[model samples]
Target: MNITVFCSAYSLDDRYSAPAAEFARLLGTGGHTLVWGGSNAGLMGLLADQVKAAGGKLVGIQVELLKHKTYPGADELVLTRDLAERKAQLLARADAIVVLVGGLGTLDEITEVLELKKHGLHDKPVVLLDTEGFYTGMRVQLERMDAEGFLPRPLDQLIAFAETPAEVFTHLTTA
Candidate 1:
């Protein structure tokens, strides 16, 4: 499977990094490919390394403006004119989506994907790997939206939540 990972562009604490590496290793060993933001820093770099070490393919998508900041590990590197194009490419290429701890950019990626799914643009599985209760608030907010009738579908149908990497696979398979 081609798993597009939405993650932080900056390095995070070991709490996030360790699990991310392990997740990458699992993806590699499981014969899954990684599609991600094209950069050689932070959790992105760590993941690239782990996947590569385990013989997995890395496909990176980056915008031209950030060309200088890209990493060297991608087996395939695709450049986009801008962020929107980059995101479109990411969404188009992914078989499944895994969202990990990140800031605004990551949130943007996951939200747009969810909205697209809600609109029937795609039916790919979207899983949240929320290590250490990181996404508890997001889960609550989603429930609130469902309660208020803002959600077009049940929260479970829109997004799968997993507190651990192992659970992420289960959600993915069953999503």
Candidate 2:
């Protein structure tokens, strides 16, 4: 299945590069095509680079407004007029969504996935990869929403978690 993975594009900072590359390698090896933000910043470029190195098919979506002069993570670039168009195209192409550790942009990407699933626009699985327990707090926060009745108990199933790269692949296969 085509996997649309959302991640931060902050820069090639060591703090984010290693983890992102780890999963990118595994996802590619697992035979899941990768689609992500087309940027050479932060973990975005690193992940795409690793996937390409592993002989995986990668499809990157770029927006005219967000063009970085040089895209860091794209091989097959699909340029759109704006961010909104790019997001729509990405969501349309992907079978599932995997989120790596990232900031606001990453969060926003998967939020669209959640909203889409909530509205019955799609029924694809969404994964929150919790490498090194990075997403523990966030998971707890989601649980709080369930407890407060803002989120349906079963809606929590929309988001799945994984610890290592192997686990992420396992979920993709079993999903």
Candidate 3:
């Protein structure tokens, strides 16, 4: 499987980094390719390193503005004109999507993907690794949307949440 992961490009504490690392190792050992932002910074860098170390392939979708931060070890790299193009490429290359702890950029990526899924643009499974309740607020908000009939489809059908690295795969395999 080609798994697209949206995550922080900034360094994070152990609480966040540890889970991301575990997930990366799992992705690698499972023989899945990682499709992600091409940054060689922070959590993104760590993920690529661990995945490569565990024998997984890396495919980076990078924007020209951040070209200097591109991961040198990626097995394949594609440059995009902008963030929008990068996001489109990320989704285009993935069989499934996993989100790790991140900031605004990560949030933007996942939301765009979800919005597309909501419109039935794609049927790929989207799972959020809700590490340390990082996504509790987002979950509550989405649930409210579902409960209030603001969503056209059930929230659960749009995305799934996993508490552990292994659980993420379980959702993927069963998706």
Candidate 4:
């Protein structure tokens, strides 16, 4: 599987890092390639390191502006002219999408992906690893949207929330 992961480009506490590492390990050992932002910073860097150490392939879709932060060890790297193009390439290459703890940028990536999915632009499975209930608020808001008919499809069909790294894969495999 070509698993595209959207995550923070800033360092985070162990509470967040640990689960992300575990997820990367699993993705690597399962013989999947990681398709992500090509940054060698913070959580994104850590994910690439763990995945590579576990024998996974890395394909980075990087924006030209952040080229300075590009991962040095990626097996393949693609440079895009802008963020919008980067996001499009990421989705185009992914068999599934996994979102981990992130900041506004990460949120933006997931939101756009969901919006595209809702419009039937893609059917790739999207999973959020809700570490430490990090996504509780977002999940609640999405549930409300589902309840209010704000979404065109059922919430479950659009996204799956997992509490652990293992659960993330379970959702993907069963999706």
Q: Write the per-residue lDDT of candidate 3 for residues 2-51, one digit (tens) a residue.
A: 99999999999999999999999999999999999989999999999999
How many backbone clashes can be found in candidate 3?
0
Output the lDDT of residue 117, model 1. Answer: 92
lDDT of 1: 0.90
Give me the displacement of residue 75 in model 4, in angstroms: 0.5
What TM-score would each prediction reach against the true structure? Answer: 0.97, 0.89, 0.99, 0.99
Candidate 3 whole-model C-alpha lDDT, 0 to 1: 0.97
* Models, CA RMSD each: 0.9, 2.0, 0.4, 0.4
Worst 10 residues of 3 by lDDT: 149-158
Pairwise lDDT winner, candidates 1 and 2: 1
Q: What lDDT does candidate 4 reach at residue 51? A: 100
Which candidate ranks first by lDDT, i.e. highest?
Answer: 4
Candidate closer to the true structure by lDDT (higher is better), 2 or 3: 3
* For model 4, the run of ten residues with the poorest summed lDDT: 155-164
Name every residue pair that clashes in candidate 3: none
Candidate 1's TM-score? 0.97
Residues 61-113, candidate 4: write the lDDT tens digits: 99999999999999999999999999999999999999999999999999999
State, as a TM-score between 0 and 1, how close model 3 is to the true structure: 0.99
